[model samples]
Target: MTKKGIVLWALLPFFLGGFAQEAYFPPAGGTWEQRNPKESGLDPDALQEAVKFAGEHEYSGPRDLRLAILKGFEREPYHEILGPVKERGGPAGMILKKGYVVASWGDTRRVDMTFSVTKSFLSTVAGLARDKGLLQSTGDRVATYLWDGTFEGEHNGKITWAHLLQQNSDWSGTLWGGHDWADRPPAEGGIDDWKYRPLREPGTVMEYNDVRVNVLAYALTHLWRQPLPTVLKRELMDPIGASTTWRWFGYDHAWTVIDGYRMQSVTGGGHSGGGIFINTEDMARFGLLFLNQGTWDGRQLLSPEWIREATTPSTPNPNYGYMWWLNGGGEREWPGVPETVYYAAGFGGNFIVVAPEEEVVMVLRWLEPSQIGEFVRKVFAALP
Candidate 1:
């Protein structure tokens, strides 16, 4: 054989090994495989230390989520419980290396409210609509498709799908008795100041507001001509082998008529109330799917291009994407972690962190929010 041919053959196994190490999918209904920490290039003792730290730092909040909601956002004017809220479980999480469980704590099967982590799932539904051609472009003005006065005003009419996905729409108006100005209002401003505040141009500023998030949910529901939950189940979750226990909900008065059938518009978070209630295992599965760049068990459930677009940082917030939080090496970046890492974060310390370069997916629930950066740094310290 030629010298070139011999060299190619010598490198073949290295390329094959890379492929083998990159993909692993747990079965739909059976037990997830657990890899020995040492075999997975991790220090088991250090990993346990991380897990212990997570357990010890459980969120110090009322288990009665309703009271927690009220007290947590007491400064916001007129913030009341408008949707379903459930008591959360103690610290429960799973750390996965190449889709295999490396460590887990608490009850991974217990279902609980995931708050704004639901926004990531909601963002996925929008991506599905884009893929299926239900909607055209993220850059398209929402007013063009939703002409029902939701986006009719001059400022709101300029709002695009990209704006809502990035939480920068500055779209005005109320939905389901939740006023746009009442959510996480400015620390210095009074009611009138916020209510009559000049609207920032869409996509220029990132403000975390549930009312505006719910507006995105409302628009996606209309575009899909059905409940967003139904779309998510049929397209993403079911295909991902997720269990039946997960649920998405909206406010009590969020019912709307679609195709002559009444359907409830789901909320994108649990701030006022009602969001995704799911288990840690399912959350891990979701993170795994994104870690694999939108493929599941060799099937492409979401487009890789869409996943790339979703994780790409928006202009306003360097640490934010299309509903996902990024480690953009800015103020929010975990000190020693990679800038490529992104996560889905929610109230009361629910997080699904995806680290692509490390080939890891971690679902951490009910850890104190302040300790997330420290917890992640510990986990990474265990790596080879």
Candidate 2:
């Protein structure tokens, strides 16, 4: 076997048995043919109940999204011009079984900001690069590729691609006008406490800092020698037959020159109002691709090995894999879902839940995050 094939087999341990049956996939050009709930082996009444429950549960946090947004950024008024920024929408979602749409609620076509879900997509690029031998190994230091000031310092040099994917890089730096410590600043710490905090050893401590994630975007962009979105489009998105309407956003202040070409380092969340702003159907297509083990139609869009690594639990946080949430071991992130189920979840309950065992790919948006377990329970109960 070739080196690529050998690597794929090594990664197959997590995806031991999946997609053991055949199923339908939507064609290109944003067209889909859905199955009736009964035809898809779903309980129609139960599915309706689940959909109803999903529509009723609103994001129970702040009444205004801007307040939450400013709080998250902790900076001056965000006037970034690069997006496709999110205009908060009402509840929207869809349920897919074996790649066929079984049921849907709200306006799945409405493009809304899927906050942290962008991290999964960003991590997907890293997976693609690794599969192509760009990074050689996840253990390879990110500094090897990004020799720029981004990874120049002693502490940052120790960070690796795996550490970034696992959110344990603990990389300290300011990018796009946001400080690493500024993100989710501790209530007890004063300014010096956050800025001068000693750098925790990379991969030892898992911290969800968007600045580091944006740094990943920046480094990946530098290595690819092209914009991350362009790479994602040519590589994963188009091959999956996703929509032409979808977009990945970066902050206005995040632009930089690479190889004499200008590029923007997109964020991993809509924290400062720019990340992934995609519609539900497109997001479902992305989910379904993973459910299909990164194979769309006959072509393998992403290496099974990368998908395996992405879904497997990180040592620091069992609940978090490479940007996707693992739902069974140390903590049950989504109760009643299969242990094999993993998901790309965003703030405000935007999620793309994939259950390989159940042959299901479900998406939900704008609901309370706390209510996802109940909602997921309903979906699983209604599954065929």
Q: For each of the candidates, give the backbone clash count.
A: 0, 0
Return the number of clashes found in candidate 1: 0
**Against the true structure, whose lDDT is highest?**
1
Evaluate model 1: give its lDDT: 0.92
lDDT of each residue in 49-146, candidate 1, tens digit only: 99999999999998889989999999888888888989888999999999999999999999999999999999999999999998889999998888
Query: Residue-wise lDDT of candidate 2 within 18-56, one digit each (tens)?
Result: 453466678887568888999888899999998999888
lDDT of 2: 0.83
How many clashes show up in model 2?
A: 0
Q: Show pairs that collide, candidate 1.
A: none
Q: Candidate 2: lDDT of 19?
A: 54
User: Which stretches in model 2 have alpha-carbon errors above 4 Å?
Assistant: 1-21, 61-64, 71-84
- The residue-level lDDT of candidate 2 at 100 comes to 86
